[model samples]
Target: MSDVRKPWLPPRWFIRLAWSVHRGLYRFSGGRVGLWRPKPGKWGAMRLTTSGRRTGQPRSVILGYLEDGPNLVTMAMNGWGDGEPAWWLNLLAHPDASVQLAGGSHPVRARAAVDTERDRLWQRWREIDKDLDAYAALRSSPTAVVVLEPRAGQG
Candidate 1:
């Protein structure tokens, strides 16, 4: 008999360590390494800087994103960990933020996708990551799909 194999994730500490290492690379490189633009049919990495919900200080992190029309879509999964990512939490208290793309940086406003918007963006993510649902299943709550809309002067 054949059996289904569930998705596997590294230990929580390992996941956290990996994130720290990645952020370290970006910081140590002086903005020279890391971050990329999302290409057609693929997700890309970028640096998202948001204001701390409590401190009002700037907090930055690397994230994967997909381009949808003029907006950017990213997930609020903390490496599929139990709680929502702190960056997402910061966004909730302060939706205004900025993203640094491979090409350039821009001001943006963030919001959680809802209803049909969430459905469509989630599907697009699934297209890029065939294991999308599998990894998300590792978490306790639904991963939020975040939309980064350009400011008034931008697209």
Candidate 2:
């Protein structure tokens, strides 16, 4: 598994440090900064709060996301590494979760994209980041594309 070509993953220490800085910036800014894309047309970071699958505790992580009509789309790419992200795994066990955006928090239902939808959304991401597929290729397994749909009467 170590031989898996993960050209996108930075050094492990850098990953940890970057995550801390990103999370700190988001928390410190009250969802204003580090919460969305700085560029005009790109995915922004949001805090996805999920219930831990094993511990059943609230767990939150920052992730880049794209708006898709009524749904929010993200990926299970753990910084372009091999294994799936914890939030995605948690959602698999318990699909109910919450997302914190620049506006506010809302309850959402999580599901992985399928078939043609997956292809379409993947293409959408490609439009945003030309190197998306190249980063995805670094994984030994297929990176799951996750969609977060707002729950009725909840947002």
Candidate 3:
């Protein structure tokens, strides 16, 4: 994919710095706040834990996500430009993962949404933020819309 076509956002140094501060504050607050607080506008944090594909070690990343019905959907943002994100690749290798949202943590299974599903969700996502169109355009491989479904009886 051409670098010029990629949907690279502005340098996220400030956002990362703020996220670090927020993470620390949440830790200090006994994990009560900051989990659902909006950063600016509609963006917020989503903590996802997945097992390492090769090492079987646990890894966690705080990402931005959007809720879609009973599923939690997250764009493979980096993936659009540079193939699938490592964590997402890990999830593909091991579908069992966990997501932390406003209410609580729940075991989830991750998979790339089907074509029809992607078309529908992409429309909804674009409605939320038009910037995603650029992201969708940059995909070297098809951009994956990951669906995180709650484990049976866990919802």
The prediction achieving the highest TM-score against the true structure is 1
Candidate 1 local lDDT, residue 125: 95
| Model 3 score (lDDT) | 0.74
Q: Please, what are the lDDT tens digits per residue for candidate 2 over residues 48-110?
A: 999999999999999889988879999898888789888999999999999988778889999
lDDT of 1 by residue, 1-155 (tens): 02324578899899889888988998899878888887777889989999999999999999999998899999999988789999999999999999998888989999999999999999999898878888888778999999999996631
TM-score of each: 0.91, 0.88, 0.76
TM-score of structure candidate 1: 0.91
Better by lDDT, candidate 3 or 1: 1
What C-alpha lDDT, on a 0 to 100 scale, does residue 44 get in candidate 2? 77
lDDT of 3 by residue, 29-60 (tens): 77686677333236556788899999999887
Stretch of 10 with least lDDT, candidate 2 = 1-10
Q: Note each model's CA RMSD in angstroms.
A: 3.0, 3.4, 4.1
Segments in model 1 whose C-alpha atoms lie over 4 Å from true places: 1-5, 153-155
